[model samples]
Target: MKIAFVSYEYPPDNAIGGIATYVQQAAHLLAQRGHTVEVFTASPTRTGCEAFPGLKVHRIQPLNRTSFPQEILATFAQRHHVVNFDVIEGPDCGAEGREIRQQFPDLPFVLKLHTPSYMLAAISHIPMTRLAQARFFLGSLRRGKWPQSSPAYHYRADPEYQHALHADVLSGPSQAILHQVQTDWQLNPANFINVPLPYIPPAISLDIPLDTSTQRVTFIGRLEIRKGILDLMRAIPLVLQQYPAAKFRFVGPAWPSPQANLNMQEYLSQKLRRYAASLEFVGAVPLDRIPEYLAQTDICVFPSIWENFPLVCLESMAAGRGVVGSHAGGMAEMLDGGNAGLLIPPKQPKPLAEALLQLLQDPDRRQQLGGIARERVLTEYSLENIGQRQEASYQAAITRHQLKFTNSPSIHA
Candidate 1:
């Protein structure tokens, strides 16, 4: 199978988020399994091709300054002239999937769901700008016949929804995400498939057990308000009130947007300055080094306000670390309803602090939960297992596309 992945971010460019990790790991795994894999990504400094056995990384430099969607289409058009891909997949976080599908009508394009704009607008309590409010209002209108330049254009003319409506297949990382999309967009239940994210553990050994004496609680995500970083900061004091030995570590970059007036850096410097000695911000640890950090962490905390499927939680579980994640989006689904680890409400300090203290105070319980978490990851989220599922989804998409185009009854239906 010749698979092509279209993402703006890829390895050696920048690890923007989970999407980069997803593309790199999935493409690598497919290549290792003897499939020809090619990654098309935007690059500022480098252009042309870098090859590694079965995998080829194409860095695309747009000839002109255009919208990201147009840039992706331009790159794809150039690449399509050289090589034909059997299956093309891109993230739903951007317009790449829909744009590609629109340009290459005959090609089989699969839109992999991340977080939809509609869901984000619904979940986020951050006071919206008038433009954002209009966007939501427009989303409530017709699904496909939206104006291009309206203020609500981005929301109403969502590329993810467009891709889902017309693509060969629409897939997401978890059932929870699929359900949310179906409910919010009023789409058919059968239109979406559950193709779980693949987890390839780092080269580092997972034999090291966390030292419980220091009680290290680690949060591995961008320090944004939506990620519950502020809530986690508030929880630290409450946690210290009970478990004095608790030390916190935040391992990622900070994202302070214009709409949200809060400054994480200032908050950390001023409000949480007294506990600065106990809290360490290992700013933006590389993806490869995450296993090293997890090895040192007794408990992994992901107090995100909302998420589709967080790769951090999966990675922590694969590293044999007990996770204390929020009961938002796919956290509870991944944790198996608190069976593997603890789940607390997001944006609440007391519950988060309580969960942290409970896990930190008991070494035996943490070890037990960690064991369960790792076992679950091995059973369900292994690369081989997910690869097989993904292959099946692709084949199904291909068959559906061929049958539908042939003027035959829809095979998927």
Candidate 2:
């Protein structure tokens, strides 16, 4: 099958988040299985074509003010005469799906739902000051118009909801994400598929021995309140109350705005000054070093307020570390309802700290949970298994597309 992936973030050029990693991994795995894979992406700085053994990447430079979906369609139209694809898969959280379906009416297009703006707003609990709230409400009042100048334009004028309405197939990394999108969009459940993220564990030995006596807790994600960074910071002091030797590490890049990194650094310096000796902020570690870091740690904590199957939880599990994740979002499904690892409520420090303390004080329980976590990844969330599942979804989408063509009712008005 000739498959084309339409994502702005592909490897070697831009791998910003979990979606890029998933797309790259899926493309490679499918190529390894003797399928032809092509990626159509946008690169502001550079534009050209690159090739691998079984895969090819085409990068385009769009005009500054032009919409991304329109640019993608124009690029595809110019290239489709030479190379045809059986299926084109792109993220649904944008206007791309609606545009592509409109431009190429007969083309088979599948839109995978990652995190939509509406879903984010629905799950978000971060408080805002009156000034900020006033700004957001005023921006939203514009309605259907994407004012590039407004700070909240992305959240307010998000076109993913419209895209989903026209998508041939709606897929998500987990059932939780799928259900939430379906309920919110009022879509047919039969149109959705539960496709778990594909994970490839690091090749290096993760069997390094660790100090079991001292509790080493790690958190990896954007340093934002929505990621439960504030909650994690608050919980650290509580954990330290019981185990003074407990070490905490906060990893990953900053988010929300350009100055977020500076702001987070300031917060750490001022608020967490007393615990500076025990806390370390290793900002934005490379993806390759993540497994090595997790291998040395005893437990991983992801207390995100909202998520659609985060990559860190699965990576931590694959690294043979017990995870203390939030009870909300897809964490419950990932952790198997506290069976694989400990689960805690989001935006609260008390229960989160308690859960961390419980796992930290008991090495036997941590070891047991870590073992189960690793086994779950191996048995279910592996790259090989997920690749096969994705392939099945593509096939099923093709079948559905053909059936739609054949079963269309006559429309003679």
Candidate 3:
């Protein structure tokens, strides 16, 4: 199959996010499977072309604009160099999907919903603000709190791309995402499929052996309130009351926004100073060094309020550490029926801290849960396994579009 993979981020840029990693893996894996893949992505670091595996990465560098991504894709439109494709797939779309359809009427286009543009528009600031406003005015909307509205009809009804895309396939990192997309867009269940974010078990080795000796609980992700950093901070007061030695270690990139990072840092730094000895912020560590940090830890405490299937949860399990995540979002699905790990209520510090304390004080239980999580990840979430599933989805979308086109008399040259 000849696939034109388009994304706003790709490797080396590290883009340092869940979606970037997933796109890189999917494109590379599909390329390895004999697909002639040409990738079109934004080069934040530098503008040019590069190659990885069987794919050629074309970097679309935009002129000075806060929202360079939407600007570049929307402006390029029919002018995009890579026009003809066996399938025109635009994931995480807004301008890309909308504009591609506007200019390329003959091309059969498909869109994948990562998350609703509205939810992002809500929490997102500055640069993303305009894109959000554009999305709302275009007919794409929000449904409720947890589930994002369908991105299907939203794209189809769009003035630019509405009539260009004849078929759509929806995917997110979890069942929760798929269910919401189906309900909001009024899309058939058959039009939606679940393809989880791919997990590449790091070629990491334990530099420091698991000592089975500490009651420290480690949380990996942005140190923001939504990530349950605040909840965990509050839980520390309670955790110390039960187990005096209980400590929480956080390792992730400081928030990407400087102002936001400063605000969060001041709060977390102040809390750390107040505790003086319990709260530890290891700051942002590279993805490769993650296993080394997990090596000394007994449990991973992911108290996030909402996550689109956290990649850190998989990383923790892959490192043979027991995990405790929020009952919300895709964490429950990652835990494999709740038997693989513990799932606690969101925003509630009492249960979250208790779950952490329980795992911390007991070495045997930690070992048990850790073992189960490792086995489950190897069985279900390995990059090799996830890559194949995503490939199948990509092919499925192509097949569905092909069938629809071949049967329709309107599909003409």
Candidate 4:
């Protein structure tokens, strides 16, 4: 099968957060499974891309100034109809879907909801101006409040909705996320599928056991509020109240927003100055070096308030650490209520702190959970498994769509 994935988000330019990770894993796995995969994405990375064997990648200049939107060149590319594909998939069917479908009306446009642009904007740096406009736009669209710009709303509002509605199926990372979106947008539940990523875990060895120390409670992610940096900070005080020996090491950039209202890195630095002796900020540690930090971590704490799925949690557990995270979005699904690792309630530091403390205080339990944590990720969320599932989904989608078209049935959304 030949599959072409369209997205504005791709690594080097901008990672679609966890979406990039999932796609890379999925595409690679599909290629390995005797399928040819091509990706059309914005080339934000300066070096074009390092290249992945068996996958044809095309990078287009961004259209909307925003990374996800396509440029005029992308518009041309979508209309060019130069490629041969048995199946086509995309991160979402928003403007890209609408514009592309204008040229290829019969193309099977699979509208994947990878947390959606609305959610991304909320997590990313939505300028107050955009925020107000977005909230108003989304609110009106949701409540049937027709704004002048109402012609343009979600991927559903794209002109292609009617043509692609039957051919298109909405997919997400987890059933939890699908349900959340169902309730959030009041979409028909029958239209969505809970197709979690069947991604293979990177073949890195985090085989080292914890050294049984509290000096490292690792935080991995772009330093931002969406990841619940503030909640994590608040829990720091609580964590110390129990395990006086505990210390924190924060990895990655401190903010997701390039345009900031308050610079989180500077803010955290100032805040950490109060506990400067106990905390370390190894700002934006290279991905290769993350294992070294995780190897030393007694526990992994993710205070993220929202996530469809967090690769960091998967990565942390893959590194064999007891993960403590908020029960929001896919974090809750990934954590599985500490069956895989701890799932703390969202927006609360108390449970998060307690979970961290529980692991920190008991080396034996931590080791047990940490060991199982890695196993669960490697077994269930492995790249091979995720890829296999994605392949199945694509095949199922193709077969289903082909049959429906052959039947010439009247399609209705």
Model 4 off-target regions past 4 Å? 45-52, 63-83, 93-95, 121-167, 210-214, 256-261, 403-413
**Candidate 1 backbone overlaps, count:** 0
Error of 3 at 323 (Å): 0.5
Mark the regions of model 2 whose C-alpha exceeds 4 Å error after superposition: 63-66, 122-126, 129-158, 205-214, 256-262, 409-413
Question: TM-scores, in order shown?
Answer: 0.87, 0.87, 0.80, 0.81
Q: Give the Cα lDDT of each candidate.
A: 0.78, 0.77, 0.67, 0.68
Summing lDDT over every window of 10 consecutive residues in candidate 2, give the lowest-scoring window: 147-156
**Candidates 1 and 4, the one with greater TM-score:** 1
| Candidate 2 accuracy as lDDT | 0.77
lDDT of 4 by residue, 67-152 (tens): 34335335335434565566667665354455554555455556666666556555554334577678887888999867554233
By TM-score, the candidates rank as 2, 1, 4, 3
Q: Clashing pairs in model 1?
A: none
Instruction: Score candidate 3 by lDDT.
Output: 0.67
Candidate 2 Cα deviation (angstroms), residue 100: 2.7
Please tell me which predicted candidate would have the highest lDDT against the true structure.
1
Number of colliding residue pairs in each model? 0, 0, 0, 16
